[model samples]
Target chain A: MADKKKKKLTPEAQQYQSYQEKREVKRPIFKNCIKAFFVGGTICLIGQAISTFYIYYFDFTEQTAGNPTVATLIFITMFLTGFGVYDRIGQFAGAGSAVPVTGFGNAVVASAIEHRTEGFVLGVGSNMLKLAGPVIVYGVFSAFVVALIKTILIKWGGL
Target chain B: MLVGHQTWMFKNKPTIISTGTVGGPFEANGRIANDIDILHDDMWIKQDSFEKAQRTMMEEACQIALKKTDVEKEQVQFFISGDLINQITPSTFTGKTLDIPYFGLFSACATSMESLALASSIVNSGGANYILSGTSSHNAAAERQFRYPTEYGGQKPPTAQWTVTGAGCALLANKGTGPVVTSATIGKVVDMGITDRLIWEEQWPQQQ
Candidate 1:
């Protein structure tokens, strides 16, 4: 039978396995949540600051300023991605770095920069979408579906 | 009650035979750069990915630690290490190459001391004759995963901290001719009654 022939680890191997289990550190879920919460909120606070900039300086109302604010944030993020500044913030903030629209820009430009040596078409163009691929695909599809439902409600339901 | 409430003292003195440190260019230019055992001029370490480079440095640090002493990699009982990246991938991947028993740890900034303490305890307990304790963090890789890429020109506020780029490994043996591990007290868990209503409970409210 296979059971009789089954081999066991040598003493050293057994001890090694035992030590690995005994000494391993567990992930700190609550601590990480706190870090992510503050860092993420800070990123949002930056976004709000940018939105306010557009509203106060450009004479756009707060409600109307959101559109340009997102664009401005993404623009700043892209530049920060280029200048190597965002990364320092990301290191301290962790999830704070990824929770903003800026993070999406960072992801795209990061992969592009990482793969720049591979040439534009094959490297930057392709790799930029690699992480964003799923998000963008689902985003468009969901939007289309939602728009279709809205049209149906407005036309057929006569609401 | 003794020196500090958070510190624990190991019964046995775990001597550190040797240490291996690998630093990138920035650290190479630091005050202790000349003191580093091995220094790489480039952050990539000629690897395709920053994370991979971190792994290579960590492995090299371990190898150097073992090499400094008569102990072969095979003779080492275990590797206790981790990194700043998600999942502590660099340390875990290096563990794969070392092919020794490994305990992937993540204590963020304090990981180096944390591993040393744990290794001392294990060796002191007679669980093993030798253990490797270390941690590594790459400037570029840590930033990429946690913040922004190198190219991002975001202006850092005056208070922002910098990542420590390099790996530091120490070889702890039951008997050796070096500094010994005396005692290690674990950290304290403080609760300020900041409740579940705080969405970002993992982080402090104000940190730039």
Candidate 2:
């Protein structure tokens, strides 16, 4: 789709593009994927530990502990964002830091802190969701669509 | 005067009398820290915002540039500077504080050299007695505008370059005992037609 959208370029631009391609340094995809896997797994391990702590001490079941677990992750992410460490982790881990619930928390909190100079109402309140707003919107919409499909199939097609 | 299609050869020989460079804590710890005029341990530099901090750095750089020379602020005829920000606010605010005739330029990374060339041309042609040419940028301010927020968890590729959080100014005069600006060649914009920023991310890393 992207390739199709590209407009025709002049001969000079084409020559420059080819030259840039030749000189451009490449990214280590395999190494990045390994790093992402380990980092992502570590985040999940920490999340599981939080969930287990709640289950063992607070008398919460595995199903009920998920909410508090997610909340704990986000709270930790808030601290990381505040201390200016998460961005570095993000640069190193790439999808590892970004594919977790903490990444979502970072998204909202980072924008909020970044816009703090503009004031609370116009700055923090309005621009807080600038990055993560689309994710929430599409997420809810897709969930609703999936639920609708499930309901129709269960009622008519007998599962 | 224009010597060729793009180059300008200055016959009057505009000279750089003095220079001032103010850097952030990151640069203060770097290898060239000794070369910087003023080093601020804090990224904020005691300012309320990153933009304001950038303006403060520019102001300090300009002041230091003047203080290093026999020239006074009133003697400076033009202030040419710019930064990577919305509407180039940092440069404008610095000009406001200096109260000098300002020319806010925007050439992305080339802003410093562009301002210097323009200032040299003006001084060479006897258009101004003294011109302060400078440019500034803050990492947080630039990241917020060009990429993600300062605290955002979005990853930057290995090929990504860090923006320098500092300001530098040069005092150019027609008559001075310093290095002279003989000629300047301005470059034109070129579009390579590669719009995908993630193409670099797709390539396999080469072994060192």
Candidate 3:
């Protein structure tokens, strides 16, 4: 028992001693921070640019331009998702990109691809709703409830 | 998969439309001769709170979709549904309540389209006489998985698609005159290494 104890300590002490003897390489947190900042910032900037482009080039009103901008964003995201590039961005930027409308496209395409390996009927056909399923349910129900209220208001309250 | 064809005889469009009953009642609309039941139980919350809401919403949507399609509960050859929860609780509950040959699917926002595509294919191929495809999502449930809560006050960028907090249902039948689903071309998963670093920096200064 005592010998086993010494043997364990020997390896542990050697490991610790080697670690202490090695030169400590200081990694600047700012490097990753900077990378994240620029990469994240650039994505937002592009979104803003697209929105501005819709407003300027497409001559859309500020409010109306939003719709076109979203459309453009979705379109681009769909393309990126199709090419299998958005997933990498998602891993690097984390929630920064996945939280946007583009993420919706990613979720859709990712789930579809995941299911596709199962074959058309059982795979892609069924797995497409892996992410966006809840969005549709809430959308429809909320709209239905809102529509119900609107109907009540129109009929009785006279809005 | 069995390759077989079955056709039904109908005089008119054979379409059913139900309204004011969540989705609608096909029996009331005179589309289906038998009674099509709608089930909504609060007991689902105990099994899973998130799925409870989703099941409620999906049940309502299926009720409506069934009514609209004029398909009877017994007549439905298969039911397909999906949600964002584990094992797709919504779809499972839906399958249980309907008690028919059914399947549950998950594909995120593309669920409705996916379900419909499959239903159409099955009906067209004569593998099924009547098929139901449905998908549902809840805002609270989705936020927990995809983002922060609404109370989080997170600024939504212009790129976000306002999640439709509802469910959509469609019925496919060999007897209907509506456009048949001939073929479906599914979208593939593609990725580009465009970093969102710039977007994050511009949007959230505190994070920087």
Candidate 4:
């Protein structure tokens, strides 16, 4: 795609683009992946511990412990976001912090606090889902599509 | 007046008679804190919104510049300023408070220098006797406009710039006993066909 776009540029612009490309900073994708793996794994480990705790301490079974565990993680994330610590963690962890339920919590809480000055109804309430709204919309849509495919396979394609 | 294709050689040599610099807590903790005339303990500067805070800081910087030279607000003929905000509202509000004939510029990171250049050119050409040249930028306000909210969790590349929460202004005059502006060169836009907002990879030591 980039090459296709580059072909349309003027000779001077193309030359400059190539020159810039040589000097451009390459993203440390390998390092980021490693960091994300460890950090994301650690977050999942904590979530598992929370789930186990709910299962063992409370009367809840393994099947019913997921909701409380997610809520707990989000609550923790809300505190971290309010204290301005989660942003720093996010800077270090990249997608590790982002691709988790905690990240969604941070998005809502951060936007809420950020636009509070504009008033509650217009500012905090409306803009609260600005960042997380897309994630929710698409997440549910993708799940629905997957569920539809599963139902079609079960109903039409004999087991 | 016109020196080269993009340069201007000022004959009058407009002088920066006085200057005022305001900074937030982050800048206050920096090495050049001593040079800052007014350093606020908080980023908000007691304003309700970050935009309002930015405006207040700009006004404070302009006021300090005027006070240092004992120049009356009426004496300053022109106020040239800019910022990174959408529509440069902080600078406009500062102009409204200073109540001077205003010229709002938008040069992003180069706003301060651009304003100074224009202010000097105007004073040098006898278009204005006194000019206040300055720029203000709040980190939060700039982030809200250009990037994300202050509390948003996102990783920025090493080359990403931090929008400083501060304001600085210089009182330039046609005749004074201080640093003189001799020339000004306006920049030209050069597009390199690169659409990536984030660029500039760090060259390793081995490469160097």
Give me the candidate number with maximum lDDT: 2
Q: Please, what are the lDDT tens digits per residue for candidate 4 over residues A14-86?
A: 9998887788776688998898789978989999999999999998899999999999999999999999999
- Determine which window of 10 residues in candidate 2 chain B has minimal summed lDDT: B199-208
Candidate 4: true contacts recovered, fraction: 0.57
Off by over 4 Å in 4: A147-159, B196-208
Q: Can you write out model 3's per-residue Cα lDDT over B120-178, one digit (the tens) per residue?
A: 66665567777778787665556545553222223343234444444556666667556
lDDT rank order: 2, 4, 1, 3
> How far out, in Å, is residue B135 in model 2?
0.8
For model 2, the superposed segments whose C-alpha errors exceed 4 Å read A1-7, A150-159, B196-208
Report the lDDT tens digits of candidate 1 across residue range B1-208. 1356667677677899999999999998899988899999987889887888999999999999988988988899999998898989999999999999999899888899899988988898898899999999998877666653465423233334578789999999999799977887788554332222212223322221
RMSD of 3: 23.7
C-alpha displacement of B34 in model 2, angstroms?
1.5
Q: Write out the backbone clash pairs for model 2.
A: none
Best by DockQ: 2
Candidate order by decreasing DockQ: 2, 4, 1, 3
Model 1 spans > 4 angstroms off: A1-111, A115-159, B1-6, B189-208
Model 4 lDDT, residue B68, Cα: 87
Comparing 3 with 4 on DockQ, the higher-scoring candidate is 4
Clashes of each: 29, 0, 64, 1
For A34-119, candidate 1 gives per-residue lDDT tens digits of 87688778778988898888888898997998889888878888887777777677655555676567767776787789667557
Interface RMSD of each: 12.3, 7.1, 15.3, 8.8
